[model samples]
Target: MLSTIVLAFQRWDGLSARRFTGLDNFAFLVKDPTFWQSLENTVVLFLMSTVPTLVLALILAVMLQSAVRFTNVYRIAYFIPNVTSLVAMAIFFSSIFSTNFGLVNAALRSLGIPQQDWLGQPWGIKIAISTMIVWQWVGYNTLIYLAGLQAIPKDQYEAAKVDGAGVVRTFFSITLPQLRPVVLFTVIMSTIGGLQTFTEPQVMVGNSGGTGQSGMTVVLFFYRAAFLDNDYGYAAAIALSIFALVLLFTAINWRIFRGRSEDR
Candidate 1:
């Protein structure tokens, strides 16, 4: 941590002598268009993945909680993706989203939809990376939600059932309200994970972030600067910016959830 802060002020290209540049790196960062673009892409990917991931995870958790047959098998199945190697997952998704001769395009063709390039376009790149992130993390989150569901008092559900409440009604009135804290935890954790996204995009699109840098993320941007470009000082500054962004978003999440609780 201290080294990063020091490096942020000193310019060094790994093999060269360290020269103190003070805020020069930061100033250049302010004027760097790619940095801003990467920031925007990061946020876009974060929202693209995090929202659907949590929603699907919560729904899966609810279903799993009610399962009576092959319960352990189902739980293991859902969690398999989380434990699988990320590189392998990225490669697998890359094949799935390939522009030509891919299952996704094939499926679209079968459904009478026009086949679209999944990795060659800007939006498609973001979607592909976000989908990979969701697939990787959703199972872990589902298990978290399942644990929270299990911890809820059985009496609350029994009372709702006795009152002739339907599954949908009970889920909203009883289940959701009780899971507020768990939901908040998941949201914050997702925010952190989303902002730090690196491997999927790097693997899927390469270090250049693909055409027009649409797939560039903050961490990937930093990695490119530090390693590929040998701009370690600038990379350090970028790292600090990433930290600040994560902190800001986390605080926002905390406040939003805390306010809801107070309102209740």
Candidate 2:
């Protein structure tokens, strides 16, 4: 591992290896418009997935925890997508978002709306990627939340009920507070996953990341620069940038969750 790390920093046979560039590679990355664009795209996709995914997962977990009939069946159904092949799922999404024969376009046309060119537009590609992320991860998050919910003692709910607290009040006062650690775990994991998202977009939009490179995440950009374009120095710099971004976001999330825990 140490040798590999050293090798990454020192390019042996390339033009970049002739002399140490210090922080020049990083500086070039900052100046690159595509790098900035890819960063922006990653942030947008993260927002599109993280918020709704957590919210829906929490709701599903709570519902599943209740003694509803067929709860096991529901859990199995929700988790199926998470275990499915990502490439196959991406292909399925591609068909659903197809401009002409896609289910989405077909629905739009039926509603008297013009068919959208989903893969050919920037926001559209981001939305499509977001949809895939949400679909793929919501189940896993739901299971995490369900486990957290199960861990909460039943006596607490009984006590709240005896104190004349309604279900909503008890949920807000007891359930949510108790779930903080689980929520923090999910948020941190999601931050790491969101920052490194590549497969769905790559499969759905191909290696170039679709029209205008809207679907080109930081990792995808790094892959293209390093492997496809053979610019290892710049790719290493991009990799470090991605690492920094993930660290920054994860730290922010930890701070936020830590504060909430302290307040509780």
Candidate 3:
């Protein structure tokens, strides 16, 4: 990390002698439109994937918790994607969302809808990447939420039942409140994962971030700068910036969840 910080201020192509450039790299970064674009795409993808994943995971966890048979089987099935190789999954999703002769477009056509190019448009690219992220992580998050649900004391549910609480009421009042810490854990993990996303977009859309650069993410941007452009200094700067951004966001998450816990 220290090496990266020092490198951020120096210009060095991997093969050339190092020259100190001070903040020149950062100065250029401020004027670079692509940097801003990549940041926006990262946040957009984060929101697009994390929100749906969490909501779906919670719903699935609740349902799984209520199941009386084959609980382990259901849990294992949901978790399979999380352990699967991401590059392979990304390639699979690429085919699924392919512009023509893809399952998604074929299904849409069967419903009398025109086939939309999934990778040829900006929003489509972002959507495809986000969908891949959600698919890969939702099951992992489901298992996390399931673990939290299982850890809840039975007395709480018994008490809620004794009070004539409906399922929804009990869930919102007892289950959710008790699971706050677990939710916080998942939120922070998801945020970090979202910010550092690389493999999915790289595999699905390539290092250039696909058409219109819509799938560009912060980490991918840094990777391109370092490996492709060979601008080690600028790449180091981007990497440090990403680290700071992740730290800032993680602190924000801690404060928000901690504040809520205090209030309750």
Model 2 ranges off by over 4 Å: 1-19
Local error of candidate 2 at residue 31 (angstroms): 0.4
> Mind giving the per-residue lDDT tens digits that candidate 1 earns over 138-157?
99999999999999999999
Candidate 3 lDDT tens digits, 180-201: 9999999999999999999998
Summing lDDT over every window of 10 consecutive residues in candidate 2, give the lowest-scoring window.
3-12
Q: Against the hidden reference, what TM-scores do the models get?
A: 0.97, 0.93, 0.98
lDDT of each: 0.95, 0.89, 0.94
CA lDDT for candidate 1? 0.95
Candidate number achieving the greatest TM-score relative to the actual structure: 3
Descending-TM-score candidate ranking: 3, 1, 2
Residue lDDT tens for model 2, 102-191: 999999999999999999999899999999999999999999999999999999999999999998899999999999999999999999
**Best-fitting candidate, measured by lDDT?**
1
